[model samples]
Target: MTFDLRPWQLADFPAYQALITAPAIATAIGIDAKSTVSQQQAFENDLYQTYQAAILIDGVPQGSIVAYQRANELGEPLVNEADIAYFLSPAFWGHGIMTDVITAFIAQLPPHFTLWADVLADNIGSLRVLEKVGFTNHGTYIDLFGRQIIQFHLYR
Candidate 1:
């Protein structure tokens, strides 16, 4: 199915929260960093300033793609290296919904050398999605769960 991505709004929190509640997704995309409505509003306000959204499907709020710019050390600045994070309702898992959404989402970003994602070690389904989309396993990180998890990168 074709999905349309939109800018995430404060009102979208209810839908986003609902998305995070999905067992499979929550295990990866993380639970609310903002635990209150006021916090959600704060995140929404900051979202636009720091991030861009490419949401999936009209009226469904099925998922979102967030992009942001960050600086690095060692003096060499990188304009690329977009870090992507996404999730879908458990019901949509294994249906290639994310594969479609990602295809659409990547096209929206400026041409860059690579796309990166940090997936929870246990989120096998997400890893498969990225791999199916041509991402290669890169390295690992100590995520919130306090365990090392693999990271993926897809070069364009």
Candidate 2:
């Protein structure tokens, strides 16, 4: 099955929440499995300033892809960099949906942009997806969850 990425809609919130909270999906995507739609929205409001899109399969909101400044805090130095985050329903894992969705998203980015992403060091699938789309590993660091994080970057 094929899918497309489109600007996110308010109506996609519920499906987005559902997708992110699925047990295996949440674990792989490195998000709290208990987050509600409201919490998700707050996150989007805070983190999706640069870009946000819903992953649609046959018109259904199956997941989301988003990018924004890695540090949105007030004191952080402004930078021409964005970090991407995405999650899909377990039902669609290994289908190369994200590989396709993100490639298209990156191509449409503004010039001089540097895209970044962080995946759990153990999530081979996500790491492979990032590498497949030309992202190079910058390094690894430990996250708050105590899981090792592999940072990936793409320069345009």
Candidate 3:
């Protein structure tokens, strides 16, 4: 399967709205907002703060990937560090699409910047993907939400 990354546009909103609201995808991706409208607003804010792209397979939006300024548990932004996050539709899981997506994204990053990611310890799949893309586990810490998160970083 071919994967493409493109600048997220207003035209992609319908697909994005549908993808993030799927119960399985929402739970795994941790979008706790109750309404799609709020989620889209937050999404727009995130785009303002960082870079984001749509993950399309054969021109259909299947997921999204973003690299943005690090945010604390309470949503305070931290500069200098790029925090990467991605979510694929449940229909696309287990296909190595995310692994490929992340690898490609990493390749395009500025080598001088440090990249960071936090994964829940129980999120084995996510951890695997991070490792596969050359991220080293830094440490584990409790997040603002009170969940244990395994921190990973790639320092260039």
Candidate 4:
């Protein structure tokens, strides 16, 4: 299957919403399963401010990958470090689409920066995807929702 990554457009919101709201995707990413429209709107607003891209398969958006600067407790951005996050439609899971997307995305990023990804401990698929892309386990921590999160990082 041919795929491409491009900046998100307003028209992609519906596809993005569907991917993010999928039961497995929402739970793994800590999004409320019953998220309100306002909440989704707010989330979409935040996406526009970050380095985000829509993953298109046959010209339709089926996934997303984003990177945001890491922040300290004081809300200061950390230099040369960023946190990466991504999600794919459940229909496209188990096909290695995410692995290929991430590999391509990382290739286009500045090599001096370090990219970090936090995966819910129970998200075996995501954890494996990170491993496949050369991200090493950095540590683990508990998220606000009290879920076990494993941190992985790669030096580009």
Number of the top TM-score candidate: 4
For residues 25-138, write the lDDT of model 2, one tens digit per residue: 677665666656544864466344657778889999887788876556765844768888887777888888889999888887888888999998888999999999999999
Q: Identify the runs in model 4 with alpha carbons over 4 angstroms from their true place.
A: 38-42
Q: After superposition, which runs of candidate 1 have C-alpha atoms over 4 Å from their true positions? A: 32-34, 37-46, 49-51, 74-77
**Tens digits of per-residue lDDT for model 1, 12-94:** 77777776666665556555444666446534643674445635565678776775444478745468766777767776677
In model 4, pairs of residues that clash are none
Reference-based TM-score of each model: 0.79, 0.86, 0.86, 0.90
- Candidate lDDT (C-alpha), each: 0.70, 0.80, 0.81, 0.84
Worst lDDT run of 10 residues, candidate 2, spans 41-50
Is 2 or 4 the stronger prediction by TM-score?
A: 4
Q: Model 3, range 9-122, lDDT digits (tens) per residue?
A: 877778887888888767666776478777788567545644778899988988888888876799887655788888888888888888899988777776687898888888
- Cα error, candidate 3, residue 69 (Å): 1.7
The clash tally of candidate 3 reads 0
- Per-residue lDDT tens digits for candidate 4, residues 1-156, read 668999988766777777777888788777776767744773575467467888899898888888888889999998878889988888888899899999999988877989999999988999999999999999999999999999999997
Query: By lDDT, highest first, what's the ranking?
Result: 4, 3, 2, 1
